[model samples]
Target chain A: MKEKEQMKNKTGYIMLLIVLGLYGILYFVHAGKTLQALEATFGVFKTVAPILLVVFFLMAFLNTFIDEKSVAKHLGDDSGFKGWFIALFGGVLSHGPGYIWYPMLQELRKKGALDGLIVAFLYARSIKLPWLPLMISYFGLTFTVVLTFYVLVGAFVQGIFAGKIMNEAKKDR
Target chain B: MPRNVQRLKETSLQTFKTLQSIAPMLFAVMGLVGIFETFVTPEMIHKIFNAHAIHDMLLATTAGAVSVGQPFLSYIIGGELLDEGISMYAVTAFILSFVTLGIIQIPLEFSIFGARFTIVRNLLSFLFAIVIAYMTTLSTSFLSGYFS
Candidate 1:
């Protein structure tokens, strides 16, 4: 168990090294653009940092004050259709890079949230209402409507498929 | 005061631990995505979708899978691609792939979730993205034909 965790912790640093190595090659290929890429990296970091801090604070607050019992009671394994609705609503409401949501989802799962609902939630993030009007304006009403419908439907389908697969995989482990 | 202070300390410690776990992955993802944005400019996006062959949908899909950004931006990009005379099939695949697949973020994803779950979910999403895009093309042409 200890070795497993140490290996897990090393993964991020290894990935970082590989990315930097690519950037090194990119520097030789395009010196000016490589500088811009470094700036963009900082920009991405700035955009994500505050939001991630918020999530971390929320996690701490919940860990300290809110018991998992309450969250689990509603979104737990038997949460059914209602749980799906909750998850979708939450996802649609969510904003920012999807990576930030993964840790939050893991927290939700530990609180007994259904696997399917979590997957559905991630898929639903595609339909941001603020952008819906923009999408329609660009893609037109009919195309927007059809695409949005498929996205919503796709979320549920993705959810069910992910849920079952993840569960079965876990059981095998 | 002592008990409350201890409780506060524990929560602070927990939050720090959370930040520790998150910070590395966050930085790694940001670094790669920054490079992607720098090199894969809109001009490049236009170039990537050049082929009009029916099978070129896969090429468009591959581009989409690699690129990551706001879903709304993809619509605007898709519109621009449409205006560029790219085939509907390729455009649709690009839009769907933009939202669903995340080749760039796979490392971060795998770090949080296990390998099996991450691979399976992404593979399923990639397949669905293709199917959804294909259906959109088929239906849109059918609608245009019927209406006209």
Candidate 2:
């Protein structure tokens, strides 16, 4: 057993080395351009990272404070109109790249939140930031409004479909 | 009143137990990401995605797998690529996949949702991104011709 554990550790290290080696080769060839990209990336990370870290900790704390059953009681499928509003608002209020929220979302799903609410959140990210004037200037008002409406509507539709599909999938499981 | 207080205590205990269960996995991943970022170089990224239109979309989707960042950052990069004459299709695919699918987060997803569900969801999301991006580009072109 001890030998097996050492072999696994050795294999993991070897995999890491291979990945890093490829990156090194690519890095040398494009060092100058890549540095410029890294500089720009670091600049943006400076602003977004701290804010995201704060939100992560706060949400984690809230997970501790609020009982999942209570949240489900208020926000679950049977909550009707109020529940839908909660879903929409929750989606709109959710910040960051949606991918990063996946883990937390998985947690929420386990807590009994409906698929509709999850879809609402995903679609809400399409709604541009409050500085909508930039979007208006680029895409025009009609395009902006139509797309936002479509996204909001599409989200709920997708949620409903996903709910059915996921349920079926679960039944098979 | 005493019964109510006892019930509340039980609920609190359950919440704490749940939080404790997930905390280590969460922090461990975060710590690993912090270390990994220190060594990544930008050229390594560009070479992986710098190609022609369809190929670039594939590259972008693949790049998105191992890459981690915010959506706003994707928009910024997409805007820059747009200025550099990259195809709208490529940018759209990159931005979409950048937000919806994650390569680096797979470990965490597996831990949370189980490996099978995580793999299925990510695969579905990736393929859907390609379709959505292609449609978005086509629609934009169609609309532009009509509106112009």
- TM for every model, in the order presented, reads 0.89, 0.64
Q: Provide the lDDT at B70 for model 2.
A: 46
Candidate whose TM-score is highest? 1
Best by DockQ: 1
State the displacement of the C-alpha of residue B16, model 2, in Å, after optimal TM-score superposition.
3.9
Displacement of the residue A172 alpha carbon in candidate 2, Å: 2.1
In terms of lDDT, the best-performing candidate is: 1
For candidate 2, the TM-score of chain A alone relative to the native chain A: 0.77
Docking class of 1: medium
Model 2: CA > 4 A from native: A1-85, A96-108, A119-154, B1-13, B35-38, B146-148
Tens digit per residue, CA lDDT, model 1, A18-74: 888888999999999999999988988888888887777777766666667866777
Model 1 per-residue lDDT tens digits across residues B2-106: 875677679768767656765676788899888988888777778766556466688888888898666776787788888878877888788878876778888
lDDT of 1: 0.78
